[model samples]
Target: MFQRPGKNEYLESQERYVSLVPAEGDLLTILKEQTAEMHSLLGGLTEEQGNYRYAPEKWSIKGVIGHLTDNDRIMSYRMLCFARGEQAPLPGYDENDYAAAGEFDRFTLKEMVEHYGIVRQSTLALMASFKEDAWTGRENSMTRK
Candidate 1:
């Protein structure tokens, strides 16, 4: 089981997100369980429900799922780069831009969730492939000018 990362292991800006993870637990198992939980929770929503937005400016349920899927892919890629000891400067991304580009409303929620499942499966596979030492490897040159 991978231990929770130290505060210093990630950027201060990411603390809010990092702290959401429980301090103790098998990370992989939690990830798998979370996937099932998401599927259970979102699987029942109708396509119309998925298209609903709280406000005109807010993303629909489908957009939210698409954004999460995109975030997962990006985060997993960063992890992969870290595990491989890559030193290239990693650029940041704007979630708003991604969400706008996705045009998530065109697809059904089931399609979006299924795509998420595929991405999560790949993420699980990548995490499982990492050696013990790879967990400690990180790209420290991510700072931007």
Candidate 2:
């Protein structure tokens, strides 16, 4: 028989696996800085370099960036649902499916990076406008155990 996770196990799992909830005042700033850093790192790559995968089955650099953008969108939506006090539990997503569907390998690195920046900006704006209570409010995440 399978045993339920104990309190300690549950807490540890959360710390090890769950995404950190940002404090409202710092959320936008943090996201902006992170987005800038990501762009800077990826900005100089050539198309061939961006499309090169580490292994045959691995994702290319562009694919990884695309995946990040997809996750950002999904998380932002989940945050909106939580802030709005939606009662239903949000659904999980398969990153592989999303990344495959995104066709990142076909995109130029610059384009993928710009797309990520745009999504990050939109997420920052959404977080900036959230009410004070919404910042502190808790909601069950489908991606979290």
Using TM-score as the measure, the top candidate is: 1
For lDDT, the strongest prediction is 1
> Clashing residue pairs, candidate 1?
none
- How far residue 23's Cα lies from its native spot in candidate 1, in Å, is 0.6
Give the residue spans of candidate 1 off by over 4 A. Answer: 138-145
Local accuracy by lDDT, each model: 0.86, 0.75
What is the lDDT for 66 in model 2? 94
Q: In model 1, what is the error at residue 14, expressed in angstroms?
A: 0.7
lDDT of 1 at 126: 96
Candidate 2 lDDT tens digits, 24-141: 3355666678788888889888999999998999999999999999999998998788678778766878899999899998878889988998999888888877887675533432
lDDT agreement of model 1 with the native: 0.86
RMSD of 1: 2.0
Tens-place lDDT per residue, model 1, 64-143, is 99999999999898888777877777778999999999999999888999999999999999999988777765443222
